[model samples]
Target: MRNFMSKKLLILSEVFHPENFVINDLAMHWAEEGCECEVLTRVPSYPAGMPLKGYRNRIYQKTHSFGLPVHRVGIVSGYQRNLVRKMLNYMNFCFLTTMMLLFRGNRYDRIFVYQTGPLTVALAAVISRMLYRQKVIIWSQDLWPDTVFAYGFRKTRLRMVMLNVFVKWIYKRCDIIMVSSEGFIDKIRKMVPGSEVIYVPNWPDINCKRVGIKSLPEGFNFTFAGNVGKVQNLRNVLAGFALFAEKNHPNAWLNIIGDGSNLKALKSLVEEKKIPNVNFTGFRPPNEMPSYFAASDVLVISLNDAPLFELIVPLKFHSYLTASRPIYAIVNGEVTRLVKRYSLGVSADPSDIESISGGFERLYYASQTELKNYSANAAGMTRNGYSKEKNIAMITSILWPSEIGLKQADLHRAM
Candidate 1:
C-alpha cells in the first residue's frame, strides 16, 4: 500500500455511473479517502446493448462524477443477445482504452481493474503495465470461461485452450486478485499458481429500511427482483411456482420486478402455461426495492445450476438479507450453504423443479414464528460482518494497507 496523498488510482470497468454498479460507491469512497481517483470506462451501456439516450459513442469524452474524473471511450453496440456482436463490443473497448492509456495513462500510481465480464477487458490493464509499468489490481466479479460456458457456449478443445491461456495470462500479470466469493479462491489458484487471491463478498448498496409499502395482489406474495436473465433460471422458477400454485397454494403469487434478455420468453412461457397470479412489474431502481420486498411474504434469489453459478453469492442475496425477508433460494453450493448455515430460509437445487416447488411449499406453509426466526437470523448475520462499511474496509485493507495505516487490531477497533 502507498500513502493516499500521493497515490493516484485508475479504475477500469465496462459499466459505471448510470448503470447501477457498486463500483460507483467504491470510487466515491476512495475519493473521499483522499486519493485522486480516475475512472476509465465506456459510455453507460449495460443490461441493454443500446447506449443510454443522453450519451453518444464519441471517440473519447471526459466528465466528473462523485468527485472523481471519468473517461468514456468508444464501444460497439448491439451485443446483448448476439455472441459475435458481444465480442466486437469487448474488442472495441479493449482497443480504444488500450490506445488512450498508452498515451495518457502514465500518471497513475496504481490501477484497479473491475473485471465484470469478458476477459478481454484485461487487455487494457495488461497494456497499461506493459507501457506504463503501473501495478494492476483486479477485483473479478465473474470467473471467465466457466461464465463463458454458462452463457451457453459449447466448450470445444480449441476454445477451451484459448480461454485457459487467456485466463492464466491475465491472472498471472495482476499484482493482486480479489474475488467476490470464497468459492472462487481455489479456481483462481488452479488457474494461476502462486497468485495472491483474497475473498471479498459483495455488500448491499441501498439502505434496508422499508421506504414505503406496496399494495400487493391478493395472495401470499413471493417476490424475485433484479436482473431477469437466463442466468437467473426464471423459466424453471416459473415452472416450479406454477406447480406450487396448481397443487398447494391457489392464492400464492410470484412478483417479478426486473427486465433482461429472457423477459420476452419468460412472459411467453407464463402465458402458455396460463400461470395464474404471476405478475411482471418490470425493473425498479435500487431505492424503490424495499417497498417491493416489504410487500412480499418471501423474497427469492435464484440462479441456473451451472458450475460457475455454484460459486457465486449474488449481490441481491445481501440486499435480501438486509431487507430481513425470508429467502426462497433456488440455488446450489455456496449460496445454499449460507442459507442453511444461517437458517435464512429454504434452499432448493436450481435444476430440480420438484425441489424448487417443495421449497415454495415449505415456505408457504412455514409458521409465522418460523418465518420471524429466519428474518431475525438474517438481520443478525449482516450486523456481525456483512455491512457495506465492513466490506469496503476489508478491500481497503487488502488493496492499501499502508495507505489506511492501520493494523488488524486497529482496523477491527475502528469498524
Candidate 2:
C-alpha cells in the first residue's frame, strides 16, 4: 500500500480556529491522524468582522493552532453589516490567497478547499491546479449563484450568466466537488456537466459534555443555539413564543444563546414588544453549548422560508442530534421532513406565527415518555446517518485512496 503519511496536505479555508467553524476541528483531527497538514486562511474576523484580540490585520502573518501551522491573510473589517465591505472581504481573500498559492504551489501533494463562504475562495486552488498540477478537492458547504441571489443580489440576466460561468469555471477545475447536502448534487451537476460530485455531510464538531450551568432559569427551556443572523428568522421565532406565552404557557422560556448581526435588533424587538420570559445569552463558547442543551427541553432550528434554504442542511442539525435533545424544527423542507420521518421532534412553518405557537403548545404538553422517545430517536439517527467516525473515515479514504487500497469506483460505491 502507498504510504499516504509521507504526503503533504494544504487546507484552504476562509474561516478556521477562533472563528467557531468545523474546518478547525477537521484540520486538528487530520494532524492528530498523522497527516502532514497545514492551513491557509484569513485572519479570524467572522460574525463581528474585526480581528480577534492578540491578532492584527496584516498583509501576511503566521500563527499556530494545536501545533498546526496556519497562514493568515488580511481581511476587510466591518463586513458584518456593510454590504460593500462584505464584497471586499470576499474579493480580498480571493486575491491574496491566489497570489500566495501561485508562489508556494509546489510544496503540497494535494490541496483541500474547505469552502464555507464565497465560492471565490476556491479560485486559488484552481490556479494552483493549473500551475503546479496538484490535485484539488473542494468540500462546498454553500452553493454560489443561489446564495449570491438569495442574499439580496440583483439577479439580472447578464449577472446570472456571468455568475454561472464563473461557478462552472471554478468547479470544473477541481478533481472532486464534495457537497454537504445530497440536494446540492443535482444542482451542482446541472451547473458543471461531467464534474465529479460527492456527498460528504457535516458531523457534530462540538464536544457535548453536559456540564452544570447555574444561571439557567427555572422553566421548560427551549434553546436556540448558533448564529443569530437575519436568515435565522429570530423575529418570527420570538413572535411565536410570545403568542404561546400569551396562551398561558407561563413556565416556558425561550433562550437565544448566540451572537450575530441580528442580535441587537432581536434584543430591541424583545424590549419593544415587551416579550416575557425571553432571555438572550450573547455568544457562549462551544464548550458550554452542551450545558445549555442539557438544561433545555427542546432545541430549536430555524431558517427563513426560502427555496434556497430547502436545498441545504445546516451544521447545527447534526450537533443538535448528537446532543440527543428533542428538536423543535420551526423551518421548512429538509429539516421538517427529517424531524417528522424519524420522530425526532415536532415541526412548524417558520413564516407562520400560529404554526410555531401550535408547535410550542404540542411540545409543552407532551408527556415525559414522548419526549424521551424523541431523544432516543435523535440518538439513533445520529449513530446511523451522521456518525462522526464513519464520515471522517470516508473523507480520509477519498483523500488518500491508495493508503486504503481503494479505487475511485470503490469509494463511489461506499458512498
Candidate 3:
C-alpha cells in the first residue's frame, strides 16, 4: 500500500491464541502487514472448561508469542450445551468486551471483530461507532439467529421478528462484512444486497508440510481433527469407519483427534457401538498440530450438510489441503465445489455411513499415479491460490484501496 502512516486496528474475538484459533492468526497476519493491531478478547478457555495451563483469568495485559499486545476481556469459563448457558457464555464475552472498551484505551482507526459467540459483538461495534465514530470490519462466518436456531432456539413469532430486525440493522452498521467462503457471500448478498460480503478464506500454519512426504504406514491412517461441536456431524463418521473396517480392509484406520462439548456423549457412543477402526486422541497443543497432520495419510472434515455450514469453509480446510494430503470432506456446497474444482479429494454424504464407507474404500486403494496427482493439486492450492501473503495483500488493498491503486495485474498476481 502507498500510504505508510500508522493506523490503529482493534480486533475483538473470544478465541485468540496460544489457544490456536482462526482469529488469532488473522490478527497476527495483519500485524505483520504493518498495521498497529491490538486484540481485546476473552482470557482463552475453550474446548475444555479450564483455562489453558499458563493463562489465568485476569484483568491484565500480555503479549502474544508474536509480541502483539492482547487486552483480556472476561468470559464465562465454560462451554455448556444448555442453550441458556451458551447464551450466557456468549453474553459474558460481549458485555465484558463492550464494558471493557468503554472505560479503557485509546481510540482506534478501525475495529475488527470475529464471529462465533454472540450478536453482542455487533452491539459492541455499534457502540464503538456511536461513542468514537470508529469504522468496523466484521468477519462473520455464520449468521446469528440462523445459528441460534440451529442450536435449537427455534424462534417464536415475536423472537424471530426482533432478531430479523436486529440482523438487518447490523448489516448497515458494519462498514465491511467478510465471510469465509464464496458460498456464504452469495447467501449474505441475498439478504443485504448493498452490504459488502468479501470472501476472506482462513489461512493455515503454512510453515509446516513444506517438506517432502514420508513413507505411509502399512495401512492408510486417516484423521479428523478439530472441534466436534453441533456443527460437526461425527456420529455417522464413526459408523462409516466401522463399516470400512468390517470389510476386513487390510489397510485402514481412523483417528479422531480433538475434544469438544460433545466429547463425553461421542466417546460413550463409540464404546457402546464397539466401533472398530476408530480412535480418539483428546486435544493436543497448537504446535503439535502440524506434526500430527504431517503424519496422516488423508484428512477428513465433517460438517452436517446444513446450509450454514455449506458456506463456512472451515479454517481446517487450509491446514488439511496445505499438508498435501488427500481430503475427504463429508460436506457439501462450497467446500465440495472447491475440492472438485481443484480435483483435490473425494466427497461423502454427511449422515450416511454407506457414502462415507465407499469414499474411504475408493481412496484407500487408489493407484499411486492418481494419488500423487491429487496430492500435487492440494499443495498447489496453497502456493498458487491462497497463500497468506496473498490474503494479507488483498486485505491491505481493501483497507487502503486508494493507496494501493492496484491494477488487474496486482490482483491476479496475488492468486
Candidate 4:
C-alpha cells in the first residue's frame, strides 16, 4: 500500500456535520491518523429537516470541523415532515453531489460513501471509481429498498426489480462492503456474491460524553431516547407503558427523550389516552444523553415488527450498552439474540402490548443484584469488542491496511 499519510481520503455522504451522524467521527479519526481527509456532503439539515442555526444552504460551502475539511454542495432543506418534499430533497442532493464529483478536479486515493440512508448518494462514489479508478468503500448503516419499505412505502414487483437492479450496481462498484449489523451480511453477499462483506458494528455517537447522574423525574423511570419515529414502534411502547403503569407499577414513569416526524402524532396519542406518568422531553444534545441515561432505572429499545428490523442492530442499542443501564429490548431477531446471549436485559415482542408490558414489569421489579448483572454484561459487551476504537480500527484496516497495522502496533505498545 502507498504511504497512509500521503493518501487523500474523501467521504461522500448526504448527511455530515451539524447532523448527528457517525461519519463526522470517522473523518476526524482519519485526520488524526495523518490522512488528508475531506468530506463532500450537503448543507446540514436532517432529523429536523431544516438548516441548523448559523448555516445556510449555499451552492457551495467550505468549512472545517475537528481539523478535517468539509465541502458542502447544495441544500436539501425540508423533508422531515412531508414525503414528496423528502423525495425531492434526496434527488436534489444526488444531483448536486454527482455534478460536483464530475466537475471537481480534486484527487483522492480512496473514497468512502457513508451509505447510511439513501443508496442514491453512492452515485458520486460510483462515478469516482469508474472514471478515476479510485477505490470505493461503503459502510452501510441501513439496507436499501428494505429500508425504503420499512418507511411504509408500498412494495411492488416492479419497484423491487428496479431497486434490486440499482442496489446491484452500487454494490458491484464498491471494493469492500461493510455493514453495521451482523445480520446484514448474508443479504449483502447474496447481492454481490464475490464482494468482500464484513461485519463492522457502529459505535455510540462519539459526541456523547459520560457525565455524572443528574436530576430526573420522580419514581422509577424507563427511558427511551433518540429518534421518536414510526419505525421505533413508539406507539406500542407508549401503549405498553400505559398498561404497565395502570396494572402493575403505578409509580413507574415513561420518559421519551427525542424529536422526530412522529413527535406530533405521538403527543396527540398521549393527550387522547391521557396516559399518566408519561413525559416527553424533546431532543437533547448527545453530550447530555449520558446523564439522562444515568438518571433512568432502565433503558428501552423498541422497533416496529418489520422484516427489515429483524436484520438491524439499531445504533441506539450500542449507546444503551455504554450507558450501563439494564435494557428492555422490545425488538426481535438479532437484537433479541444478542440481549439474551449476553444477559443484557429482558426481551419482548414489540407488536404485542402485553408482552412489552411484561418486559417492563420484569425490569422494574428486578432485584438489585439482577440489575447489576445486566449492567455488568452491558459493560462487558462494549469492552470486549463493540466500541468506537474497534470500529474505526476495523475500517482503517480495510482502507489503509499497512498504515493502520503499524498504528495498531504502536497503540498496543503504548498501552
Candidate 5:
C-alpha cells in the first residue's frame, strides 16, 4: 500500500464542499488517509447565484474543513441569469487562482485539478507548471471548445481559432490529463496529440441506504434528480411524459428534484402546458437523496442531444445505479449504450419526443420480474464496475507513482 503521509497535495476546483460535488468526497478521503491536502476554490455559489449560508462572497479567505485547508476566492453574484456576470465569474476565478498560486505555488509538491467547467480554470495550473515546475494533473469533467459551443456560444471564425489554440495550450501543458468518461480519451487525443490521457470514471458519492421515510407519495413514481439546467434536457422530458401520461399512464408521476437556473422556467413550462402529475421539488440536502431514490420506482437521466454530451456520463448515473432502481434514460451515446448493454433500463433519443414517450410506456408496463432483473443488474454493476475503493486507489496510485512503485509505462498500460 502507498503511504500518503508525507505527500503535500493541492486541489483546484471551482466548486467544493457546501456545494455538492464528487471532489468534496475525494479530497476528504485523501485527508483521512493522512495526506496533507489543501484546496483553492471559489466562494460557494453554484446552481444558486448568491453565496451559501455561513459564507459571504469575499475576495479571499481561508478556512479548514474535514482536515483540509480551504482557500476561497470571490465570484460575481447573479451569474445564474446573466450571461455577462457568468462570464465574469469564470474570468474572476481564473485570474484570482493564478494570483494565489503565484505566491504559494512552491508549497505543494503536486497539484490536482477537479475541472467541472470552463477550461480557463486549468490555466492557473498550467501557469504554475511553467513557474514552479510541479506535476499538475487535471480530471476533466467537461471538454473545451466543444463544450464552449455546446453551451450556446457562437462559433465565429475568430472565436473558433482562439478556442482551439487555448484548449490545446492548456491541455498540452498538463503533466497528466484524467477523464471521467472513456469516450473523452479519443477526443482529447485529437486535440493534443501524444498527451497522456487516462480514463478515471467517477464513482457514486451518494450512500445508498434503505430509509423508512416515504419521501414520495404512493403510486408509481419516476424521479429526475440533479440540476434542472437547459443542458439537462428536462423540457423534452416533460413533454414526453405529458404524452405518456395523457395516453397510457395517467396516475404515473414525474418528480423533478433539485434546483438550477432552469427551475423557474421549467415550472413555467409545466403550467403553460398543463402537464399533470408533475411535481417540482426544489433543492434537497445531499444526505436526503437516498430517501428520494428509495421512494422512486424508476430514475430518469437525460442530457441534450449534442455530440459533446455523447462523450460524457453524468455523476448521477452512478448514484442512480447505486440506488438499485431501473433507469429511464432519455439520452443517447454512452449512457444509452450502457443501459442497453447491461440491461439496466430502457432508453430513448433525447431529441425524439415520441421515442421518449415510448420509453416511459415500456417502463411503466414492465413486469415485476423484469424490474427486479434490472435492479439486480444495476446493483451488480455498481458493485463490480464502479467500486469506489478501486477507483480511488487507481487515482491515488497515479498521483503518487513513486510511492506505489508504478513505472510510467506500466501506469499507461494499466489504463
Candidate 6:
C-alpha cells in the first residue's frame, strides 16, 4: 500500500464506463468515492458485436473516464458465439489481463471481480489469488454455470455440467460477494444457502441536477429504454400501444431509446401496423435521459417468460426510477416489487394487453396533484437511498471490512 492514500481497488469487470450504461455508472461511482480504482476491462463492444471505432486495433491501453483510470485489455474483436471465436475472445482477455496486471508496476489492496462471463474472469481472479495471495471479492452481476442455460447458450450437456462445477468452485474461493438486486440474493441463497451475498442495488448520479419534469402534451406519451434484447417483450408492448394508438392516435406516442438485435424487426412491425404513435429514437447520452422520460407521462419496462430475468434487475429500471415520472412496468420479479414498494409506479403483465391498456388509462387521466405526489416520492427514494454516493460507500464498506473489525488482524496488508 505504498503511497496509496486511497484504497487501491482493482476492478475486473467485463464492462466499464462510456459504453453508456449502469456498469459505467458503478465504475464512475467507485472512482468518486476516494478509492483509487483500476479497472481491467474488455474494449467497448457489447451488443454491437463491433469494437468502438477508435479502439478497433488497441491492445493494452489506458484511458480516463469519469476521473477513473481504465486499463483496457485487447481481446479477440469478433466476439460472437460462433464456437471458436467466442472461446478466443474470452480466453485472450483472461490471459492478457492477468499477465498485464502482474507486470503493471502497482500493488492493489483487494481485487473486485464483476461476473458476467464468470468463467474467463474467474480464471483471472484465481490466478491473481495464486500469484499474489490477493483478496478476491466476487461481486457477481450474474450467477453462471446456471445462467449459461438461462441465456440459452449452446453447449453440450457434459460440457455444461463441468462448467457449472468450475464456476461454483470459484465462488467458494471468494472472500466476499456483492449482488446488484434483492432477487439475486434470493436465488444465490438457494444455491449457497448459508453464503454471504450482500445487496448493493444499482445507482446512478441522481444528484447532478435532474431534468425538469414536463407535462404531457394534453395527451398520453409513453417511453421504454434499454436494450432491444430477446427477453424484452416489445411484441407485446407494441401490440398494446397499437390498440390505444388506433383509437387515440396523436393523443399517445411511444418513444423508444437504446438499440439491439430486435430493433429492425420492431421497426418493421411498427411500419406494418401503421402505428403512427410509435417512434424510435436510438441511443441517447445518460445525462440526456431525463427529458426523454420527462416528456412522457409514464415510462414502461417489459420482460418476457424468462425466470433468469426475474432474478436479475436490468440497470434501465433504475433510470426509470430516476426519471421522476410514473412507471408502467410490464415486468416480473424484483423490478415490479420495487415499483410497488416505492409507490412510484404501477405494473401490468407483459403479455397481457388488457392490463397494459388499463395502466395506460390510469396514467393518461391522472390528475396533476396525483402526478406531483408520485414525482416527489420517486425523487425522495432516489435522493434518500439510490444515489451514486450511497452505493460507493456501500461497496467500500464491503471491501475494507476490517474498517469495522469484521475481520481479524489488519487486512490492510491485503490492500
TM-scores for all candidates? 0.95, 0.97, 0.89, 0.94, 0.97, 0.84
Tens-digit lDDT track of model 1 for 179-269:
8888999998998988888777788766666666767788899999998888899999999998898895778999999888889999999
Which regions of candidate 1 are displaced past 4 Å? 1-3, 209-211, 404-415
| Local accuracy of candidate 6 as per-residue lDDT tens digits, 124-196 | 7767676777788876767666567665677798877787677666766677767776677765666565667
Clashes of each: 0, 0, 0, 0, 0, 1
Residue 150, candidate 2: C-alpha displacement in angstroms:
1.7
**Candidate 3 off by > 4 Å:** 1-3, 29-34, 59-65, 80-82, 104-106, 205-218, 403-415
lDDT of each residue in 41-128, candidate 5, tens digit only: 9999877888999998899999887878999999899888778999999999999999999999989888999999988989988899
Clashes of 3: 0
lDDT (0-100) at residue 242 of candidate 5? Answer: 97
lDDT of 2 by residue, 134-162 (tens): 98999999988899887778889999999
Per-candidate alpha-carbon RMSD to the true structure? 2.4, 1.5, 3.1, 3.2, 1.4, 4.4
Q: How many backbone clashes does candidate 2 have?
A: 0
Kindly report which residue stretches of model 6 are placed more than 4 angstroms away from their true locations once superposed: 1-7, 21-37, 65-69, 78-88, 101-106, 116-119, 154-160, 205-218, 403-415
Residue range 215-278, candidate 4, lDDT tens digits: 6688999999998988999999999988888885767999999999899899999999988888
Candidate 6 scores a C-alpha RMSD against the true structure in Å of 4.4
lDDT of the candidates, in the order given: 0.85, 0.89, 0.74, 0.85, 0.90, 0.71
- Cand. 4 Cα-lDDT: 0.85
Q: Candidate 2 lDDT (Cα, whole model)?
A: 0.89
TM-score for candidate 1, please give it: 0.95
Question: Which candidate has the top score in lDDT?
Answer: 5
